[model samples]
Target: MTPIFPAKAGHSVRILQLCRAIKALGHELTFIHVASKLDTQKPDIASHVAFFGERHFLHLDNGPRQARFAFWLRGKLRRRWRKILRGFGHDHSHYSGLDENWRNPWSHQLRAMDRRFDTVVVEYAFNSRALDAFPASTRKLLDTHDAFADRHRPFVARGFRKGYWVSLTPQDENQGLRRADAVIAIQAQEAEHFREQLAQYEVSERNPEIAVVSHYIGLDQPLPDHGVDHAALYLGTNMLSNQISLRQFLEHVLPRVVSSIPDFRLRLAGSICNWAPDIPNVEKLGFVDDLRAAFARSPLSVNPTIAGTGINIKLLDAMGAGVPTISTVTGVRGLGGEFNNGLLVVADHDHAAFADHIIRLSKDAGLRRSLGLAAFADAQRWNERQLAALDHCLRGDALTDTAPGHVARWRDRTPPPFPTAT
Candidate 1:
């Protein structure tokens, strides 16, 4: 359970949910958050989940290993020392997704502590160090939240090769699949895509024991009234995809919207440094403490995303707050909805046309409110409870009787092949 991303990112959030759900199922849970320093901005989120069970931090020594005489040999000694250390390297705090380089510290430790657990639930494929460390007896499993290799397409498309991200693609991903006891895809389409593409990436065609698991949300209690904010808002915490989407939006559409509507302010929030577009209507709100509050303040949430994987969490948070949304098809792909009727899904990729639609929604309060209500209701189904099966799977509590559906679908699905981490 080494959190590869910062504690607040979607991966960490899902990990916390899986662990807690597993704990509730009468199994023990442990979280190994590796790091030299914890991202202190949000200790409470981690703290809330801490009450359930074990939390450990394995920090490796930071002293330099390279000397002037044998700089080239430094890598050799470092590799040996890495083996000696065997668990938990420096905390990769800013990594939004998994990278297969720098032997992850936990894989080795978990491999050594093999006796403690019967199965290894690898949340991401970056930690091959763990794959090697995995006990011979313990089973391995992967939850393909995103096509790990797809994220690296940018580097590949750029003609660059033999870098950290390049190695993570296909190789480590396939290794994870081949070695794992099972592979769980977040969406059905994605599961099919994984099966079809693994072979293209030089992975086995007889895909691993694949299963489709929906993204988890905390689908508990009657949603409270999300008081309204009339402004149109966009929020992102420095994800590159978000930046690309924002750039597209500003470059193509904001001028028309600002000119047409006097009060229309397209507020941009989150970790965009020096990214204030010169467009008249676009206002940068910066990152907020609780984005839910920002959603509460804005009646309309915009999802101009072009590329990203997994459920857009910001969309769900907005839906949870009962905020009406206008998102591109890709952005709205996995969010809960009925026949595409739940949210104001806009297919017009053009920013001006999309902004025109936004302007129209802004004028009509009834249409805006309806979209929010329906979206909130739809979000109820995908909440945290849905991940119970995933939790059970991770704990090796997924024997047939307990999860016959899972067994029928997954137990028979042959083990998948994933690439070896470089």
Candidate 2:
């Protein structure tokens, strides 16, 4: 069960990719979408039907009216309590939206289903409550897109008033984790964090097994170089973190790049363009229908992320398309360092060096082609490894050599040799 639809957002991409992978593994799928109260956009039901088949696709609206009214009444009371707490200088950081009571209405619906499921995979820890609807013998897995314990701290430290997505206290998050038979963390560091938190909280007699299953992208053959000279692409949604990173890149790095190569052009795509500043040589291609075509038009991609958790799917998408990429160290977090042959990592806040890499790649078509080839090769190998790991995760098998501390086994290996020809 998931709250998000299959869309272009990073998390949504991860969901769709996993679903496809599961189907490819020959297992039938039943998709349950529990719509969030804050979600205003309607999902394209036709696309969902095409992907999951109409019979298997289930979209649950915001429950019955009585349940909705109860939830609303509770929310009002909580707000009143929050206001009272604020006057006394107390902070309440728990996210009530994750409360299992919010999903109570659907429990009966899920229980009423005539079919039996061997395994039930819930998308987020907050939605893990859905697992309770199944028999105790059925396997339950929780796919945590990111760590949520004190999730708001990072955004708050970055000067934002609140976190972009969900935030919950350690105790609250631990409650969700205890319900899963195995927990799927998107990255290694987060896997370790979950283990530590579960141990610390002693939430259950046995903590759920934690598995590291990073994002996967299908590898594409390198397109013949038809890139615009001195042009780079930055594709992202208008999330607050994306806004901050792109704004900083424009303010600090773009000027130096333009000064060195006056013809330099930056292509901004997706909702990010809505907030993009009007600037010279910056072309805004809003809501690109064909991302592969967009990647083909640019010789390289840039992920200037200075803050955020989990792997950056945009970076992975660029690598999958065989485009040479430059990213801040934080941007490449949770990704294997072996892929560095195709990805250039710069220290955060080092604007001059970031610009230097951009300038260098813009001027060297041969180097760009070489790196893009390496990227495509790396993406192929990475996809295989992730698919194997995900298969193990779905089968409830203990992943060998993938323990949190043993990340070096996969992440620190020497990169495979780049293909001599593509």
Best by TM-score: 2
RMSD of each: 9.0, 4.4
Clashes of each: 26, 0
Error of 1 at 373 (Å): 1.9
Show model 1 residue runs off by greater than 4 Å: 1-7, 24-26, 36-49, 52-108, 154-172, 199-207, 219-230, 335-340, 388-392, 395-422
Write down the worst ten-residue block by lDDT for model 1: 413-422
Task: Write the residue-wise lDDT of candidate 2 on 190-235 in tens digits.
Answer: 9989999988874578788888778878554675773567999999
What candidate 2 gets wrong by more than 4 Å, as runs, is: 1-6, 83-89, 93-97, 398-422
Q: Report the lDDT of model 1 for residue 102.
A: 36
Per residue, candidate 1 scores C-alpha lDDT tens digits across 1-422 of 33533335655556655554555545555554443222333344345444543344233322244422253455466556645443453222212223323333344445445346666665555543454566667766776667665454553354422122222345556766666667777766677666766677775645567665655444332224434423688877665666677777777766667677877777776665345555566677675655655555566788888766777766766666666778888887654344234466666476766887778776666777777677666555344324444654564444344232222223433222111110
Q: Looking at candidate 2, what is the lDDT of residue 190?
A: 94
- lDDT scores for all predictions? 0.56, 0.78
- Of candidate 2, the 10-residue stretch with the lowest lDDT total is 413-422
